[model samples]
Target: MSEAPIRLLIADDHPIVRDGIRGMFTADPRFEVLGEAGDGAQAVELARALLPDVILMDLRMPRMDGVTAIKELAKLGNTARVLVLTTYDTDSDVLPAIEAGATGYLLKDAPRDELMRAVHAAARGEAVLSPSVATRLLGRVRAPADPLSARELEILRLIAQGTTNREAAARLFISEATVKTHVLHIYTKLGVNDRAAAVAVAYQRGLLTLDNG
Candidate 1:
C-alpha cells in the first residue's frame, strides 16, 4: 500500500510566498498542505491545531519571528519538526533557529525537489541544512577539532567587543596588519565571514563567555 502523504504547515508573512509554497506541495502526491500561516503567532496557533508532520517556517514574520515560534513549539512539547524556509543564511539567523529545535534550515530559493527532500527528511526527524549553510556549519563543527590558537582567541574576543583592527592592534600591542591577520584567521577557524558572524558563532560555540569582560 502507498504511504500517507506528508502533512505540511507553511508559515510566511508574504501572501505570494505562501501561495507558491502551498501550490508546490499540493502539486506533489507525496505531500499535503494542511494549512498556511501569515505570521509566526498564527503559525504557532495552526501548528498546535493541525499537528502537521513538518512546518515550513519563515524567519522574519509579524507578531513573532520563526525562531521564537520554534522555541514556543518546543516549550509546548510539539512533536512536529520545524524546517526553516527563509532568505537569511547568516550566523545569527541560522544558529538560533537550530538551537531552538529546528529540524532543518533551507533557503527560500531552494529547488522544489530539494525542498521536498528536506520536508521528507524533517518528517523523519532528520537534520537538514542548505548547501551554503551546511558548509558554514561544518566549518564550525570541525573548528573545535582543529582548535583556535591563543592569539586568535584574543583577537576574536576583541572583535566581539566591537574593536576595530587598529584598536585591537593597540590593545594587544601588535601592529594593525598583525591584528587584521589574526582577525582573518579567527574568521577561518570559526567558519564565518565577518566581525558580527564571527562573534555570533564564537558565542554559540562557547569560545567566548558572557562574563568575560
Candidate 2:
C-alpha cells in the first residue's frame, strides 16, 4: 500500500493564492490539505490545532509576519516543517524566516512541479531553496562579509532612500566630487554599474535592511 499522504497546512493572506494552492495540493494523492490560514497569526493557531506534517507559509501577512509565526511555532516545539512561499527573496525576508526555523524557501513564482518537490523535501525535513535564493546564499557564504565599508553602506542607504549624490554629500558635509568618487567605488565593489543596482545588491548582501524600528 502507498504511504499516508503528507498532511499540510496552507497559510497566506491572499484568498486566491490559498484557494489555488489548495486546489493543486488537494488533487495530489500524495498530499492532504489539513487546513488553511489567512495570516501568520491564524497560521500559528491552526498549526497548533492541526499538527500538520508540513506548513506552506507566506512571508508577508496581515497580523503576524511569517518569521514571527515560525518563531512562535518553534517556541511551542512544534516539529511541523515550514516551507516558505513568498514573492520576496531579499535577505530581510529570507534570512529571518530561515533563522526562525523554516525548512525551505521558495519564491511564489516557482514552477508548480518545483513547489511540489520542495514541499515533499520539506516534509522529510530536508532543506530546499529557490534557485535565486540559493545562489544569493551561496554568494554570501563565499564572500561572507559586507563587501562595502561603513561609509559605502551609508551611501548605499542614502541611495536606497532616494537620495541624490548632491544630497548625500550635503548630508555628510562632503564635497560632491568626493561623493561621486565614493559612488564609483561603490559601483565597482558591488559589481553594479549604477546607483539603484548598488542599493539593491546591498540589501541582498545584508549590508542594508528595512528600518529597524
CA lDDT of every candidate: 0.90, 0.89
Task: List where candidate 1 sits over 4 angstroms from the true fold.
Answer: 1-5, 27-31, 60-63, 87-96, 109-114, 128-146
TM-score of 1: 0.77
Any residue pairs clashing in model 2, and if so which?
Answer: none
Regions of model 2 farther than 4 Å from truth? 147-213
lDDT of 2 by residue, 116-193 (tens): 999999998899999999998888679855367778778778889888999999999998898899899898777667
Q: Tell me the lDDT of model 2 at 30.
A: 95
Error of 2 at 1 (Å): 2.7
The candidate that wins on TM-score is 1
Q: Which ten residues in a row have the lowest lDDT in candidate 1?
A: 138-147
Per-candidate TM equals 0.77, 0.73
- How do the residues 1-213 of candidate 1 rate in per-residue lDDT, one tens digit apiece? 999999999999999999999999899999999999999899999999999999999999989999999999999999999999999998778989989999999998999989999999999999999999998788767664358898888888888778899998888899999988888888776667888888877887788999762
